[model samples]
Target chain A: MNTFVLLQVSEQVAAKSADMAAKDPHGIIITAVSVSVVFIALIILYFAYTFIGKLTSGQIKMPKIKLPSFKKKTAEVHPTPEEMAAIALALESKRSGEVYAAIGLALHQHMNEKVHDNESYVITIKRRN
Target chain B: MNTIIESLQQFWQYTGFANMTYQHLIMVLIGIAFITVAIKKDWEPLLLVPIGFGMIIGNIPITEGLNVGIYEEGSVLNILYQGVHQGWYPPLIFLGIGAMTDFSALISQPRLMLIGAAAQIGIFGAYALALQLGFNPAEAGAIGIIGGADGPTAIFLSSKLAPHLMGAIAVSAYSYMALVPVIQRPIMLLLTTRKERLIRMKPPRVVSQKEKIIFPVVGFILTAMIVPSGMALLGMLFFGNLLKESGVTKRLAETARGPLIDVVTILIGVTVGCSTQADVFLTGSSVKIFGLGLMSFIIATMCGVLFVKFMNLFCKPENKINPLIGNAGVSAVPDAARVSQNAGREFDKSNHLLMHAMAPNVAGVIGSAVAAGILLSFLG
Candidate 1:
């Protein structure tokens, strides 16, 4: 009897679905059902996440995984006094070269009058002259 | 001389000028206008430029039986268009979206998800309206998804339920998405009082990386269990999110969000635009779809704002939500969220609502996909 009743209910649902499929869909019912289903689904997500949020209110303790360092280790070598002096001279020469190049470019532009004057492009007439 | 004359006539017949119709000219002009707006106005240029160019390509008059048009089975355009028609591009697009999205805001404030669900009233509202206007249920469902403010979701649902209307629905969905700021701002302002706009709730709590990683996996299981039909879109979305959040798959996540999404976007945008051949797109139904789409967008914005106000009634004064951010409940992504920030700044410069608005904005993506799934289950 229980089996029969379950079968009957299943049949009724199938019939109802078929009926809905055959007819022009009842918009009100579709809207209500779709809205309800979407709400129910999202609401479930909301509650689940909310619960999770509460449970995990404190900081999560994740196991630290140590990654291999990619940096290469070089042996520390002390430069002799003469070597250090040579290195310093080379650095000074490079810095002076940059400065000289900039100065030369600026001087060249100035000498050639390549830089624009900041004068306003206004015309004045002198009638008396 | 007679043979030469016949050959000349054949050549003339094959030329575009000989076969040009007013419809083709009109569509071409529309394409040019799209390109102009995208360039001059700088609105959704990524989407509009490709689509506009594709529209011109689609509308160029061609002789029959040449297998050159998008509709021709063996044509290259048609082959590319299969992605759109077969409903695969949307899921791929969703994967990219998932990879790019930061669900921290939504995770921090789960209650805000309701606003996303409420905003979906526009989908059902449009569904009813479309039915009243004589569209069948499946077509109505497809048209209604435009309210979701999600181009890919609309395309996915329409491709499944109403293939014939996919082009019109896609164009309408994208057009309305581009117009979100224009449409949503006025409605947002109209619905909320000045005080409501100025309401500043507490900042969202910081979501831990564990929570972030857990969210996609759990979110997928729960949503999919409830609406298995939405598995295609929802699964891709969550999988993409998982790839991003897992920390172990940085390269994979980067690829999904970057190059993969870009390529899919170009293909989807241009092919969707190409699908709008003048013969298929120019119709009374297309006009009605546009009208319904606008109405749906307005309704969705209104519902989002109103629902926030409703939620505000139960909350304490300090917890009250600013209705301005509610407009972000439609899933237009950072654009809708940006509108909230801009509108809120108009009231209070310090009240930055962009982060808060993103909660509902991302939730709307899930809600719309679920809504699409429901429609598909019922109508597919």
Candidate 2:
């Protein structure tokens, strides 16, 4: 080989070796930086979550307030005693086959008499399933 | 009669038994052992059963260069194996894991995330050790990740940086993860005092739906920004979590967590197992990888336990952490968490640390993924 060509080849090889050497430093630095990043990021998230939990709990107490008491008008509509008895009678008739007819009869009897006595009735249905 | 005998001999020569070697017989026995452990011990049966059967199939010793092995160019096994070789299955597994994971535990107690970070000491420790033992930087990184005890992450990083070591690394990662109870229990018992083991963590606070939904978004943004190479693994993970938490994507979430994950797990386990041919797997390097893997796993477990003990020094009495749950920081998921709870129960039957352990366990998934990303970006 000629002297000039040998010098050129050696220079190229040295440059390549230097480049490879540079990458090792970079790799070590990256490893350290990466580990640090993971720790830093997680620690930051830890604090953020703590702050968020505290904020979202909404624990700030509100001051007590005093208000003037005022009497207000209320609705006066109430079921009459007869109507109440009819309602009870209708509900009691729900289990029988003639429930509609019984309900009609109860309503008619309550309308016919201005005052009605309280009565309770029980009925049961059997299922065949 | 002579011609008939010759033809019969020719036919027999083509059979798998004709080509079988002692290595194949040994691998078959190992495969059976895996299956026995899966069935008898009930340790990671979902993974071990498939992988074990695949190992048997892989070791059947067919005629050479017949295009039938997993390494063949056009075989069906090779095609299925691409999901692993090309790094597809791991991210999909992560997606399913995300859909199934409840970040509520980690969110409720963020300090536990530090334990997850602490567990990553195993990765670096193993990496440095592997380098000293003569692996190149890329192969060392892949071996180190087995210490993370996250099989998918190990497979993902290996597929990128050290494809030749993928089989050993994957097998080692899964084996250690499956043996989390055996490996972690002793270290956990030795590291923690009885009082530390018995410390019952306060109940985790209830996380709101809004926080659950926002977590994936914020977490993805933060972690991905730091390590872009992890986007496939970490992105799918967060996306799967978003599906579950979005409330409107119930069907997608169900599919991701159910059929999708099941399918990916089978593909990953079987393909990884099939990659473990006797010739490729019985190398000196494979033995070293396995050794480093066990060491990394033990170191990671110890790091987590020690970290908790260290943290306890500054903790108030009421807020002191139980070192038992620290094993979960190695990222074996519910298995490690279960071990932590079992260890805690042994110390105090009344103590239940499963929920608390879950926080670090799931956090370890993200931690390992981040570490994998860093290694990939640097070494890849």
User: Judged by DockQ, which candidate is best?
Assistant: 1
Give the interface-residue alpha carbon RMSD of model 2.
Answer: 9.9
Judging by TM-score against the true structure, name the best candidate.
Answer: 1
Q: Name every residue pair that clashes in candidate 1.
A: none
Residues B200-274, candidate 1: write the lDDT tens digits: 979999998999999999999999999999999999999999999999788789999999999999998898888
Worst 10 residues of 2 chain A by lDDT: A1-10
**Model 2: how far is B211 from its true place, Å?**
0.6
TM-score of each: 0.82, 0.81
Candidate 1 TM-score to native: 0.82
Cα lDDT tens digits for candidate 2, B187-252: 999987777777888999999898888889888888898788889989999999999999978878
Worst 10 residues of 1 chain B by lDDT: B158-167
Interface RMSD for each candidate model? 10.9, 9.9
